[model samples]
Target: MWSLPASFLLLLLLLLLGQAPPSRPQSLGTMKLRLVGPGSKPEEGRLEVLHQGQWGTVCDDDFALQEATVACRQLGFEAALTWAHSAKYGPGEGPIWLDNVRCAGTESSLDQCGSNGWGVSDCSHSEDVGVVCQPQRQRGYLSERVSNALGPQGRRLEEVRLKPILASAKRRSPVTEGAVEVKYEGHWRQVCDQGWTRNNSRVVCGMLGFPSEAPVDSHYYRKVWNSKMEDPKSRLKSLTKKNSFWIHRVNCLGTEPHMANCQVQVAPAQGKLRPACPGGMHTVVSCVAGPRFRPPKAKPGHKESRAEQEMKVRLRSGAQVGEGRVEVLMNRQWGTVCDHGWNLISASVVCRQLGFGSAREALFGAQLGQALGPIHLSEVRCRGYEQTLSECPSLEGSQNGCQHENDAAVRCNIPNMGFQNQVRLAGGRSPEEGVVEVQVEVNGVQRWGAVCSDHWGLNEAMVACRQLGLGFANHAIKDTWYWQGTPGAGEVVMSGVRCSGTEMALQQCQRHGPVHCSHGTGRFSAGVSCTDSAPDLVMNAQLVQETAYLEDRPLSQLYCAHEENCLSQSADHMNWPYGHRRLLRFSSQIHNLGRADFRPKTGRHSWIWHQCHRPRL
Candidate 1:
């Protein structure tokens, strides 16, 4: 206690020793510059920094902007930044390589940084160019060092997240079956037999809300029937032929068949054919012939079964109870009618459209739940006479209330009409109106035959054209030529083809041709005459006129098949055609020459006419 001053001095010395030495302010140096190339070896090219006196490559795994910012700060720069590359920075020639350097934002230096080992590349080296501690200066500082680091050569910092890459890699896996469950409302449920069909595995998968091709394991269940099932062969022959007579199979667990286990309904009349059996089993047996089939006799003293008698009467009268008609309430509105005054005749029409048996009875006043719209018609009469419901005039303008509370309803009993059959057309029948030509094939040789003019009426021609799939429309009359006698000996006598003020001769008409046709007028005259040998003479005349016109022009270019053939008798006869005739002739000669020298066999020639010209002869 007497040495208090000495004790205080000793404590101060101890405290001084415990405290750390002052760091030299890190020398306050500017950040270094580095460039990373794709080919640079991670362990070699990496720059070594005096961070805690230990060297390590920056890990390139999961590098981010925040990490880069911290790195730039540690480098003595205003903002810590990073650059990533996949290619060598100017082809880093030396052995120094830092392939993948992942760094946390707090890394003190490029060398002393935590990473996913050395060579793991979070970013490609080709894109990397880095700057270390960069010197900071006020506006007046003029240091060459700062100038050198401020341009394009400076490192660029990029921010990127690596979690997305990891997530993408995790998503590549094969799909499996049955492990997934479907949720309905609040509960998840497994697929049971309720809605499954054996014919299609897809149906089961779809009902369970899974992919149609989902894998399934084998499953089986027992079938049961509980009704008085009649054996197929034991039923009446007539009844067995009917589709309604067949019994359907069912599945069950108990020895006795239950109604729920049965897949189809069983008929009562056929019940007497066999006894009720457990499991709903059926056996095949020959049907026994009996008296002409009749309904089973009712026991005596039963309320004189008015139902059966009423059914018979309805059947006899052919009245339908459920049949109805639809009418257009207005322009586009449609509504149904009630069978208030419906009878057998009207019932027949409705039943026919509905594809049912003849009318049994017509019901009135909302039998079908509700009326769709306004009642378009009222007093209805059907004698089974009209082709369509719209043809029934008696129902036209019948007053019916539009109160929207009641519907006009009718019922008609109808016999079931099966599917319609195909329509057949008679041979050689045209589906349109035109001339009827019949061909008779004898020994497989086609012979020119007589045209059956008698069947050439419009209706007959239409039928014929329809048969051959051709369109029929009226063609203009041009010319008329009559031939007397047979083909080889026939003599043409052109006569009796008339032309009205607006009508043109068939031979001269642009719409048709130079063939035989009758005009609108009563008088007939032939526009032109020619033998069969000169059938196209009219067209030839037009071609000749074009050629003659070319020859008569001056300053014309002429083309010929050959140089020697250029001066044809026809061309030599032309008057005053010149200026480029030789050139044209040479071209024509070359073109007409054999395929040897000229690539194409044709050429064009322009002609200017100096003299007025008339139509060529």
Candidate 2:
């Protein structure tokens, strides 16, 4: 062997010791940074930075929109619309590597901004930052003519804005519903309602961050406009009626990300002509606000304690409210728990902590989906009655033999429908099975009434079953006269209620709006019988051990072994049947595992008898 230099010998020694080469640290500098968390799109999530071959979150202490814009631009986005403090996307773990970051709004990357130095932070991970980047509008379909006509400022699709109209004292915060306005040709314009439909309303509502469209009361708009014109101090007559519209004749399927994505005949062509409406009506919309639009408030005079802050938890990637990958916030950082030793007892604690019911199913192996974070707890053990997951025993360490793919998840038992008074099943033995009733406002009072059975069937009954938290529809009654005479029986409130058996509630089903039925329409009142269990017959296991025994054939066929009268005095009168054959005989107890009660099909006096001998004493 040839003699080597000291540096070469040292490198060889490191390699033999299972250590990476000097180039390993260089690769960490080029590691990819990404946004990770629950979001409807890629541009929104908790702010996480990749450093030293690990991903970490930024502390939200003093995190501002300027810093958010810098982060978004680093990720190749235009700008940030909003920055969330207090971990709106939930906290993160691994390392809260940045804190008290201050950006000048034009920095190229987060690294260039002022911060408390790498891996140094006074704040906890509960304050991890989140950002929602402004969505990039589509300018693909515009022709050269249209593009040129729009000029530089309007080159992109016109923006949509909502102007608040404080019409009544009932209006409050979070500002859900507003007047629809579109920015066109560098100016805001109101939409004309010539051909406005509910689908069109939905697109506008979605743009305004609302969940769905509500029935717009057009009469209210008429009243407001008339009131304005009738104002004595108002400059109504002298002012021009030449208000221009940005776009009209909108045709949307109600799934567009923005109003610009909808089919609309846009500006310059319409701007040149005097503004006019075919229906002479301005578009007004009412939107049903979603959960996010509601602001959270702390309890009166009760600040959150340190213990309360330490025990926060959340669920992510679930289709509904109460099912998803379980994330626990520990020591200010959010991380997942491993599925090892995880069970319904552990999962139920998580569900209850999140304000949901017990766990419907405790899923293992990351069934909901793998999360991108550290597995903070492993081999979690919990009693079935723990209040929070913090009360459970767990092995603490990110390196515990668990991966993101092995993250635990839970499907929690959630309530059926949100609009409780809108639909209900009534007058049955159990709360789950009953006549269909809905609360409707008559005159100025709320009254519970029946649903029309005109188009009602098993499909519609399925919706009722789901709304009532019943398993499924066992039967749908076309006529409820049998239960109509009961107390609180009333008129029909809905007609032609049809469903596809997949709606979360009966209110989501199709109907001819809300209808009123006169009293005595018993034949058209809807009713439902729901079942909590499947139709199954189970033999009593304990009875089989004692009073019951197995019976085999030939002699088994000579008498009905299921009847108690078998092996009676009639056996001596019978001719010797085919030569005696080996047989097993036993008494059994059959239990019905179904929604309906158990009843014998035949009378006790009608039991069949045949030749069979009782065991001799």
Candidate 3:
């Protein structure tokens, strides 16, 4: 230190420490940005820029999509879809920075764009900015939402049904104990007993909403199987047809909701392997379920106190038996569930709890109808093996966080009573709308025939539409003269058909005891135009909750929302440009989360010219 200069001494000290001198200095442009907010999606959050080893927020004084695009790209997103002001994500805490931002939309980085300068802003935390980035949909790459479903909890399996051979099993409400039958490709088939273990049975029992697995009386079921082999006409014989066994072996961890989650072995090639089960028989599973869920077996005419059911699940406001908006009871209050992360796998657990089959649709946006109640659950991530919704993992949401616009619903799979096979829609522009055809047994010979169009209404069509699993009835054609069909398929087999609209099948509806048509048949057959899909249109509830406000908008400003078709149909009647409205204004984002897309039925040839729907309705 006495002999050397300060620079030379520092260089010598750095070499002694095995370190190199700085080539360049780091700047705010190289600083990493961190998104922090309560948004459930990764592509959105409050914009927090870093400075002096501390994170701060960007003010929304002059922030626009151009600035947001550069910021979004800096945050690992391709582009910006939207930007919000007034702390849309949530108010941030820290120093205010980067105000009066002005970007040219072509900037590669937010730091490169012009701003008031670092730490120069006339804004508060309440004016923090946020952005929604364009979500990545690149090929060969999965989104965060879809990839999340590939977990063990979100995995799915084929539907399982129980055939109760024991008399006691038939008495149980949910059929606690029975011979387990696995549905393979829409056909119910028996599982092979070879190498079948209690763990596999345990998994099946869990899927059926039972508490645990019980022992199966193999000695009794073996006798029933032998009887079917010895005598083909035996009632104890389980197989109704020449059912083929497709699954030879399945190994379960006893924690799966369905058999598909575990390791499975497929039976050898069909023709090569004559008997798929080899030396094995059909598998059986008995589950442990108490009488708590069953109807009370009280003394004759004894009154029982109807205590409020707790920790239970129910469906409400459904037009049919096996479909409704899902509700759960907790803390002595019945509440609805948020549709976030809701899917068919989660709905199947609700269906199994209610003694029904798998789910056909997981509805959203109060598809069945909205209910007035607290939303107790959100992000209901079901593993499908849970006995009830109470067993499934869910977040307790607040009333302000969730709304009826996001209420979850389900359409469950019911038993096929052969009603669809008995009823057919024939001769139309499409399979959904056509001249009705009914199968009639004429002296033991079944033939497809027509129906009398007299008195056919929407109520009658509702039953038929549900029976066919085609959804709601859009129209009931009184006359089908335009329908083209074979003359032989025009015999009037059914007449005087009356329905309350709650019937499950056409057989349940009241009809003429003997076929009698008040009007002529053939082209006059009872025809119906049924909707193919029951679409669940869900508005962005969280976005609405975070950004909602009652604003007295000028008539001119309302036209932007109206022209975008975001306003309700009632807005059409309002005299635009003459008066203003106190509208519940927000950024609207409605998405079709249902299994099918929403296709309008009205066509250019039929729709009135009040509103122009481009590219045909």
- Give candidate 2's whole-model lDDT: 0.63
**When superposed on Cα atoms, how far off is each prediction in RMSD?**
37.4, 22.3, 17.2
Q: Please give, for residues 468-506, the per-residue lDDT of candidate 1 as tens digits.
A: 323221221122223222332111122222222111111
How many angstroms is residue 288 displaced in model 3 relative to the true structure, after the best TM-score fit?
Answer: 14
Sort by lDDT, best first: 3, 2, 1
Candidate 2 has which clashing residue pairs, if any? 551-584, 551-585, 552-584
Q: Rate the local accuracy (lDDT) of all candidates.
A: 0.29, 0.63, 0.69
**lDDT (C-alpha) at residue 354 in model 1:** 36
Better of 1 and 3 by TM-score: 3
lDDT of 3: 0.69
Off by over 4 Å in 3: 1-190, 195-217, 220-246, 249-257, 267-279, 284-321, 328-335, 341-346, 359-373, 381-395, 440-445, 533-617
Each model's total of backbone clashes: 99, 3, 0
Better of 1 and 2 by TM-score: 2
Per-residue error (Å), model 2, residue 168: 1.1
How well is each residue in 1-617 modelled by candidate 2, as lDDT tens digits?
88899999998998899763422112232334567775334467898887876799989887889999988766656789999888889889889877878888987667767676677777787888999886442322221212211322234454555555655512554344556677655776767677788878865664444545679677877787567767866553223254455566778666443455456764344335554554355577776654322333531121333323555777755534456778877766677888888876577677656545445456666655566546788888886446578778889746566887677887664432244446776666766666788776667788777788877898888667756656567788877766643456467667777786655556556776547444336655888887643333567655656764454445435544434544545555555554334454556666543323445557878665333434433
lDDT of 3 at 424: 77
